[model samples]
Target: MTRSTTDEAAVPPLPSPKERRRLREAKSLSEKEVAAAVGVTRATVRSWETGRASPRGRKRALYAKLIAPEPAVKPPAVKPSVVKPPAVTPEAGAAAVPEAAAAAVPEAPDLPVAPPVPEAPPAAPPADPPPAPAPAPNSDTRSGAEAPDERRVSPAEAFDELYARTAPGLVRQTYLLTGRRALARESVERAFELAWQRWPEVAVDRDPAGWVRAAAYEYAMSPWHRLRRTHRQPDAPPTEPGKRALFDALLDLPPAYRRTLLLYDGVGLDLPETAAETEASTPAAAGRLMTARAAVAERLPELADAAPAEQSALLHDRIGGLARAEHVPVPRPARAVRTGSENKARLWTRAAVAGVALLIAVTGLTLHTAPTHYEQPISPPERVGGVPPRGGPQKLTAQDLKLQKSLSEQLAHGPERLVPQLE
Candidate 1:
């Protein structure tokens, strides 16, 4: 009992519930793994994390050590050893002195003759101070090794590394987001392309993977996908009944609830992180998580029998398995993605310039063709003066025609007839 108490005292108190979860995640450990390490059921671990329950005795100490390992104690500095000269009695001092030096000393009757000691050999230079202990590797340093050449990596190389590391898992996550494999692959590709385009911003971000993940999730969950002819029909459900049921249940959920579930349960993110990623309040995220889980359980009778914590673990495994079962096409290479992004940017820029030029030309043409001043429109033709209509020509009477003929004959008869006619 005394030893146990001493051990407990030596162990530091565990961090808050949230912090415990964070430390576990920071180490990339899942609750099941932690539970196994702590020798407890997974549910106990969950309860401990939620603060509904606490571990005691050996379990508490073990759990504390697992989640938050105590920092290594630094070794004490090596102090230089000081060599003190041995004290000598009077006789020893006289012996240490040479006979000649002792003889040269003046004899005094009252005070014993003082013996002169030869000057001590110059003290050996203090041994070189022990080389300072190599600076203890920082606890934060990866694998307790010096920082790697990654610091000198070029932007493209870094981007490629990020892509290769995350693209597969992202593709799977996207598959969960959208049931359609094709859309999932497309969304992941598009997300990486955007990341490549904005590499400068992404490279400096605290969580570059999260940045890409958010982009991918946003793309996968877009309501606009409903408008697409290809996406209008659902893809064939998974062949296995269990997978099919889980996939269908996930699809039935609201996008936000589904996302929260996936991030927290499936991706192993903390509640605050899930809420942040989903852009919901903590309570709201928790509520959604509960609702989503309950819905899944209701649909699948098998899960209904299990406790909530176990249910969550099952869901996580199922979702992961389902995602993996689908043959997600491998993501395009990072170099290819970067090249495509650059090409797209160039194309868009050219298109924008051309559009501006076209707009300018159109504006100029409109200016040239537009009337400078409003002109009164010409009026349609109308009769302004009142005039009587002329009657159609009437046929000349027969007698008038004969008189005309006789006049023409008399005129033909003589020039005198023509002169009379003129008068």
Candidate 2:
């Protein structure tokens, strides 16, 4: 059913029941129509029209207009004929009235002027009711019928999800490298924190977690880790004797060889990715992987002839099992996850503005500080045959003199003289 709106205009008064029924019958209007127009229920209109009740207040005014007799319009009273002293014959009595003289006459004050009839108020037609106040917005998505089937992932949401999914695996790979649960956790946590710091950039990246995992890998392999003692995870009890031997052998290799093996095998990254993580060329990474595999094979004969893919699969299982056994809590974001993304945008904008200001300041200072006047540009004091002199007790700094001496030695003894180790 359609709704209705309230009218601000006051509703007119209704007539007595007998008069109302008479007017409604005369107009052949339905009771419902008259009731709607009068802004009342059909029952009320029927009661008023059937001599059972009388309309009151604003409704009375409205009903009166329909049924009450109109007041007679009075003719304007004529002014007593203005008789001039009988000016006749050739006198001015015959002349029609002049415009100015008619205006000049002051009408008798005693003749009361009729007031203008006031117009009827525009009818307060019933308004179509306002759409039932639009429902209080459904704030709780779960509370109302508007349960979202899906939603677009916000950048922060997407980044947090990626972190949750990848961090444990990343920490495990780090564990394989450092062989310490604490260090691996520390490294992965640091990496995730950096990712959070630059999440805006990381969120749009094809591999958001790749940079973090790579960074964590680097962090876990720091020289400081050498000083810090390493230990097998207590939670991840080494069961198989062969796996224990493999883990021990992995620890025995140099960091470069071990890191390559973990990146390629344990992390299941390809050659290029492994290379990038280790800061090596693809060939270098492959060579290092080969070296690490050979070294592992020396300890474990089963892997000596195993295919690269098979070996990687085996290492992944062993490492993944260990990583999953221990619960390394992922680091929570400090500032990024807490504040709104808009704030991060504002920070970057502020930094850009500051950098621009600094650049302008530096440029101004450089221009202000530059020498305005100089006697002449530096040149050789003497020239021979229009060529600048090279050899002299010249006004030059010690560094310039040293460069000159080195050049002389190179020219006399060839480039070989500069190669001290060869000599």
Candidate 3:
């Protein structure tokens, strides 16, 4: 294929100052690096990055394309090695260095084939893994027969395959942590959904499945759903009363111990991994695991699954069987956004209702039992211009009223008439 003369002659469009700066910063490139990569001076690069100037012509388009995606990681620092040649004498170096570099480059036709030569060696090792990588390959193998056929999987396909194999196990592990099958199922689904979204990164992980399991466990352990609930009746009772009681006993453990217990015995992670999952030291995890087992044994001695020093596989089997036997229905797969939103809504609603009820209760109590200190205001006794008013006579006397008829004349003239002569 060939470009037309007109197409070749046409100039690429210029990029804006802001666009240039954004791309440069996104790729984490210094002005010097960007300038060198795009074949420009450092001053010009500074002008572009600072929004004082914009890159034009083909270079501007090239710069935009360069920073469109994340920059690739820089190569690891080279290690010191015995095989590396010592520095040569100046005379020998001048003659040999150029000749060696030139000889190292294969012919133009052989250039493409050379890459495959190195790739072929690493590719075959997956089928026949080195002894150092034995444990990993074994765990990844679906079966003895499938181990030979196990090949490199694309990110999407690897994530799907991992989810299918590990989801049930993750659900069971979460059930041990949360004490609810529905919660376990929801947690597992959310974890895998995350794995799917981040498959490109997760696929290259050393233990992608472990990463997802840890995430699921964390999701199940959220306090919102637990706090919003008052008391929940399980969908199905455990086949045995002992098992049910034991499960409740598990809930009583501190979160650290509970998580360590499950990560070690329920999920079958090694002590170091369990510690990592629980954010504890290896010795601390071991201690917690031992203490949890002892606690469980003390709580329910008859439970073989909880017996001290019982194998993890047996615990897994017993718990798995019990979980299934007690399951009434399969819960729908969970969405992270939906679960989080619903939990927050439930918590807020419960809190608001409780607050209103408490306020009403306090008000009613206050109204019913008025304080003795609160009394009616009374006016003091009446005063008569600074003297207290006296009470009137209780009964009336006969002499107090005047007679309607005049007194008899003989009685009236006897004493009083003599006094008038003196006046």
Candidate 4:
């Protein structure tokens, strides 16, 4: 026998997705069991449980029965009670006697006493109609229906989401830090680049936005900015005098104090949080915050009248306004950042390798050219201690030369005499 459409329509409604899951878990049953009982795929059961899809027709009835089964024990029948109008005497009626007074009247002995009416049994409740699903505690009205399933997103997608969500605000904030639109954009972009490079750590961070913000703040507030010619001159001040004064005051304060003030006031961080981010003690952060506030108050005549708390609030608004007023460039796309990070990593790797190779070559050259053995150095010649200074054929040379000349003259004249003597 086939079931009629009416029978299908009479099937009880399914509970909410969360309720379905809860029911299955309460019974110590898994999705597989529900799927097997309902003759559907485990995935379908999961979708039903997650509220991604609702079962229909036969599947719906089967699922409702399996997950939200009727209680085995029937509730005890209850007798119905009816309240009758209090009987009143004509005299009481004319006097507008109260119901309590009429009910209090005792019946006369001669009057026939009416018997109490027996209560009728209540009609049987619809056979095993599952109890109406109780509303989920602390759940929103919309939660009565299945909530949209939360899908697992890839890391790149998650990174892109974080970047898109925070990049614009970060740009504005960095603008506040540096006061230069170009630098602000650059700082935010560079921060994202760094985040992409370390996405594993960044993605797992409790506050990814804070991580990027800190990086951007550090870049924007770097002292090395002073060396950049573009950063030497201040950006065009805000057109409004209030904003201009606020901006100047911020720039005038030291970077640490300005950052502390910004985090505590502008970003709404608590003192301890500000200190943690700034790497300072809470008292130090508080001191910087106070000092910064005082400096700003000194610069702005308007702020001078306000109390410290009011001054901080005013500064926050003004800083926010100042940041928003500047037109910072849109943040670079996550893909672009990831690509840039990869390129940068590759470049650094090559550079490190080249540096190592160059160092090795230099060491090898030094070893090749270095002297192998030690050599003694020659000493300059010196005169003998006992030897008299040699007088070259000097004055004595004149006498000797004269004697030789005389002898030579005698030999030239007496050559024939010497020959004869020799003969």
Question: Per-candidate TM vs. native?
Answer: 0.57, 0.41, 0.41, 0.56
Q: For model 1, how does the per-residue alpha-carbon lDDT over 5-86 read when each residue is reduced to its tens digit?
A: 8876766587656557667777878778999998999888877876679998888888988887558899997776545444
Residues 277-380 of candidate 3: C-alpha lDDT, one tens digit per residue: 56544567889988877777667655445334544555565556655555432433334433554566678899999999999999999988988686888988
| Ranking of all candidate structures by their TM-score, best first | 1, 4, 2, 3
Clashing pairs in 1: none
Q: Write the per-residue lDDT of candidate 2 for residues 1-423, one digit (tens) a residue.
A: 223222223444444333455455556566677788878898887667545678767886676665655577999976655433222334223334444444444456765422222232222334455485555554453554544675667766776777778776777677666667778777877777667777776665546677677678777777765564453332353567776777778888998989888778777777756665565555788999988888888887877778977877766776667556545655555344335444665788999999999999999999999999987878869745977658877698999999989887775643554545753
**Clash numbers, per candidate:** 0, 17, 0, 0
- RMSD to the true structure for each prediction, in A, is 17.8, 36.9, 20.3, 20.0
Query: Alpha-carbon error at 7 in model 3, in Å?
Result: 38
Output the TM-score of candidate 3: 0.41
lDDT of candidate 2 at residue 158, scale 0 to 100: 71
Candidate closest to the true structure, highest TM-score: 1
- Per residue, candidate 4 scores C-alpha lDDT tens digits across 39-149 of 999888877865579998888888887777557898887655333334444443233444444454345666554333223223233345458798885466564464566
What is the clash tally of candidate 3?
0
> Which candidate leads in lDDT?
1
Better of 1 and 3 by TM-score: 1
Q: Which 10 consecutive residues of model 4 have the lowest summed lDDT?
A: 115-124
